[model samples]
Target: MTTRTIALVFHRLRPNAIALARDVAAWAQQSGCKVVCDESDVDAIAQGGHSHLTASSSFRDADLLVSVGGDGTMLRAVHSLNGTLVPVMGVNVGLLGYLTNVEPEMALGALDQWLRGTEGTSFHYDDRMMLRVSIQNGSTKQSWLALNEVVLEKQQSGHTVRLGVDIDGTHFVTYSADGLIIATPTGSTAYALSARGPVLSPRLNALLMTPVSPHMMFDRSLVLDPREEVIVEVMGQRPVEIAIDGVAVHTLLAGDRVSVLAATERARLLRFNDNRFHQILRSKFGLADR
Candidate 1:
């Protein structure tokens, strides 16, 4: 059999995350598998006393990518993969890890099941939809992949930005609001939820568009088909900020436009169980049985 390559991605600032990575690295090495990590994480891994593992700038070829932090680290790992289909296994070391499927103590056992095959275990792959966002600003054009939601919000405080909405090449409506969110079904439980957007099942292939604090009367969120393309253009003098997965990336001026669509590529998550979405949700929010 060929030696498998496992890539470890972790939260550098979290001691528990680093410790988990070190343990996994040691186990992978002993199991005759190659262990790798992002080149930027080399120093941190070394400080954690696991310098023998390989450092890779890209994880496109990795058989599996292990995320040793919370949902944020898992998102970062997915971003680092850059649309590669490498399956990610998230071990939660942070609080409210909605994206993580396993805890630190059970991480190694989960890896064992994955490596040894799924014949006797409940191992499986959970595919989640993602969004592709493109921006056109005069002569500059850029695009990004978002596992969560894409946000176009006001750059300055106490100012509402004007944005024109279009769907499938047709003008829809214009709104003056604090911001707009274009979220995948997987993201409906994230930032969109806090904004009063309805929760969507992760298995659905749809988009959730919600406007934050809209000054207009039509403040309800819209559930759209994944095949439909939604565009938002800046219509006011004040510049707007574009954020992907909650990180502000660019500033859009008046007349600039952004297009959002379901990505051709999906995020593959490694799973040891099935149909736990509702259970996890209830546990995360401490919902009452009554």
Candidate 2:
């Protein structure tokens, strides 16, 4: 008998995702694998009833952590891992799942290959980024780590503001626009793409700076090397909002400076050899499979 421990994490808010988690857990258990999961998942399925599930708010030890949801849930799982070296596998519950790609039907088959040591493997480590954020009239002290992009925009629509972007203490440009987006390669396909930013390959070491509805069409997107540090200084008297990885929101005032740079940590996403980055991209974006 083979012994492998796996952590099954999922978004409890979605019924389909929860059901899929239960299925994966049940199958792993019957196949002689240990499954650490949340109680809600176990309770949802009769086969997973009375499972040795860990509490939702607590930690469980496992060799692999499985996330069942879309990209949002994957980010939550990354935070939950909290620097653990354990790799995470995503089972996309819905369409347009940028992070979650493995379909529900393919999950068990993939798991079988993974446990049998017959699967190909790759590393899709997270590119952590740093953020220097401040509130209006506040000290330049608030900072953050972002796995995706950071967005600065007007709190209310139909308003324009002046934003100065500086790179390494030099003036890059000033934009009179609705907002700006600073995204990592991993985040290029997200809100940044919707704002007209180019899609960056995941392995590329670069940052994408895109302006949202700039007053000047000349304010096209800018791609910078990963080593560069960016600072966004507000230049007008208007209420602005900052969103980090779509998880936290902060208010910024004119004269406040938001700095962004690469972070020290990396998010480890377990990848099997069968998983192809370009393939996933083409499938999601409807590009030619070739």
Candidate 3:
């Protein structure tokens, strides 16, 4: 029999999550399928006597990678995959289950369907767009990926930031606000939504420029075509912190320019026929129809 392979990633490997991973692993192994996980997760699981897992250093060639956590875990899994385009399945253990496919109780069944190829036949995939951010500080340039959004915020507390925003090399606006958020369509419901940015369809190939608590009149979010690259320059001799996907990664000194563009690759997300984006929004956020 041919050995099918599946990779597992965990959020924190709590008992419940560990049990789910083990259950999924055991089931896959029953049919001579290969179960692998990154060394980090393997070490975590080894402490609990589930060390029969293959310690993989990468997600390349994974038949399917399961993330038994929340949206953050899903994002991390995708980031680790690093443009490999591997299909990711998420089990929700966080507050917002936006990126997760199923709950912990449903994880085993979900994996069973995929492994058997019968119940999983109808499951589809959505290629969610991601952002490629490049920051230039003098001759040094650093690039990063953000599955959600990229924010340029002031380093000093209680002090606002000034960013000169441009689109496709044309001057647009200078934002006098707490910070600025450049969000992908998949991120519309995240930080952007709370800052009054309009919600975009998940399938839309677009980006949003939303100012965070602007003191000037041009405060409305601007929706731009996916082809356009956004440029934000740190102004006013003040340094700003750069946040990618909610974590502060670096601080941009004055005279730095950050460019954000749609990545050539997209995140392949696993979605079952039973799961729908609209339904999740209503269930998670209590969005009732009038």
Poorest lDDT segment (10 consecutive residues) of candidate 2? 122-131
Clashing pairs in 1: none
lDDT by residue for model 1 over 190-232, one digit each (tens)? 8999999998989999999999999998999999999999999
Tens digits of per-residue lDDT, candidate 2, 250-271, equal: 7888788887877656666756
> 1 or 3, which is superior by lDDT?
1
> Against the correct fold, how does model 1 do in TM-score?
0.97
| RMSD to the hidden true structure, all candidates | 1.3, 3.6, 1.9
Off by over 4 Å in 3: 118-120
CA displacement after TM-score superposition, residue 169 of candidate 2 (Å): 1.3
**Candidate achieving higher TM-score, 1 or 3:** 1
The runs of at least 3 residues in candidate 1 whose Cα sits more than 4 Å from the true structure, single-residue gaps closed, are 119-121, 138-140
* Local lDDT at 222 for model 2: 92
Which stretches of candidate 2 lie above 4 Å from their native place? Answer: 1-5, 31-34, 37-48, 56-62, 118-141, 273-276, 288-290
